[model samples]
Target: MWYLISYVEEALKYIEANYSEAVTIQDLANWLGLERTYLYRLFNSMVGMSPQAYLLDVRIRQACTLLTHSDLTITNIARSVGYEDSLYFSRLFRRKKGQTPSQYRLTHQSPESNS
Candidate 1:
């Protein structure tokens, strides 16, 4: 892979690895062995978003999966998806999906949701 692309990929991998914990640009940059500003620009240039935004997108994606695939409570699900604050998770979930987590789960997944 190209150097910038590889750095971006490493940033993505770090996000996946530590998604359940608090993450920061410094942490991710250190992991990728790049300076924070460089990594930030690299991600934005390649992916159209900063590292933090990308991580939020990933978190929401995992939350969507858990919301549909598991029977966990919303708060627990939030933690599993890496948001420590349940209310903040709910806000982010709603912002991305336009519905509360409970509502999205009921509407998106049914026994027939397999279809």
Candidate 2:
């Protein structure tokens, strides 16, 4: 059980480092030298979410950071966060965040000075 837990942890670390790229379950399983279905079951049972779901969650969280801290345009931000299509990214952001990216940025942006 502890071995499986460590395996999942390693998988999560890899996912965090490569979430901006097209990381897939098969890729992870191949890298871990485990069967795809077995890895998926272990990961889902331990993490309470599938690998793909976790990847999307990570990507959206990164997008949130870029939205709040950067002045990059929405399209550019979307691309920077591994989204090739800003419209699709906006839709996904709305679904996950309950607001469009632009709306989120506007509401969360730091106050500007009149100077």
Candidate 3:
């Protein structure tokens, strides 16, 4: 169990570091030397979400950071977060954050960034 937990942790770290790249469950399993299905099960059990879900979460969270802290354009920010389709990214961002990225930045941007 602990060993599985460690694998999940490593998977989480990989996701965090590579969130701006197109990563897949198969890639994670290959990196961990585990079967793809097994990695999915273990990740779901350990993290309460599938690897894909977790990846999206990380991407959106990173997008949120970029939105709040930078003056990058929306399309650039979308690509920066590993979303090649700005429209899809905006739709997903709306689903996760209850607003478009622009709205989020408007509401959450730091005072210094507001200048």
- Write model 3 residue lDDT over 5-108, tens digit each, in one string: 89999999999999888778788899999999999999998899999999999999999999988899999999998988999999999999999999999999
Model 3 worst lDDT run, 10 consecutive residues: 106-115
lDDT of 2 at 75: 93
Best candidate, TM-score: 3
User: Model 3, which residues run further than 4 Å from truth?
Assistant: none
lDDT of 2 by residue, 1-115 (tens): 7899999999999889987776787898899899989988999999999987888899999988878777888998888777889999999999999999989998887654111
Candidate 2 backbone clash number: 0
Assess each prediction's global lDDT (C-alpha) against the native.
Answer: 0.87, 0.87, 0.92
Q: Residue 5's C-alpha lDDT in candidate 3?
A: 85
lDDT of 1 at 37: 93
lDDT score, candidate 1, position 102? 94
Candidate ordering by lDDT (highest first):
3, 1, 2
lDDT for 96 in candidate 3 is 96
The lDDT, on a scale of 0 to 1, for candidate 3 is 0.92
Error of 3 at 71 (Å): 0.3
